[model samples]
Target: MATINPVKFIQQVRAEVSKVVWPTRREVLLTTVMVFIMAALAAAFFAVVDLLIRTGLSGIYGIFG
Candidate 1:
């Protein structure tokens, strides 16, 4: 098995972390708003589809019954 060096590992981790480009506050807020908007739109679409399907099934039952 190879030997492990704790000090060298910590230094490498810090170096990589420093290279990361973190998102700005504006970008985070915009993306968060977009996510909420998309979620609401999706929920509205599914609700309409469900209503249409239920109405169709009820009509079909009424015709047969």
Candidate 2:
């Protein structure tokens, strides 16, 4: 196994990072909006699931009552 020097490793990392394609501001905003939309959808799904579970448990209690 070859041992790496920290300074050389950091330089190599920086060189690779320079080659990355960064997103534009508008694209970032659009992605952020989509992320929020997805999060909202997930929350809504869990809310429906929670309501169904609560309703079912209440129905079981009603039977015992």
Candidate 3:
């Protein structure tokens, strides 16, 4: 294996980092909001499904037990 010099490695790392396209603040905010919205929607969907299943099981037990 070849070992890299620390100074050269730092320079290469900075050069590559400079080429990155960082997101704008507005873009970041929009994506963050969308993620929260989707998470809330997913949580709500699962809550409804769980309630339905629980209600169904309760009904079945009421009849048999």
Q: Which residues of candidate 2, in runs, are more than 4 Å off?
A: 1-11
Candidate 2, residues 13-60, lDDT tens digits: the string is 999999999999999999999999999999999999999999999999
Candidate topping TM-score: 3
Worst 10 residues of 1 by lDDT: 2-11
lDDT (Cα, tens digit) per residue for candidate 1, span 3-41: 889999999999999999999999999999999999999
lDDT of 1 at 49: 100
Q: Per-residue CA lDDT of candidate 3, range 3-57, in tens? A: 9899999999999999999999999999999999999999999999999999999
Query: Would you estimate the TM-scores of all the predictions?
Result: 0.93, 0.76, 0.94
lDDT of 1: 0.99
- Please give the ranking of all candidate structures by TM-score, highest first, separated by commas: 3, 1, 2
- Quote model 1's TM-score: 0.93
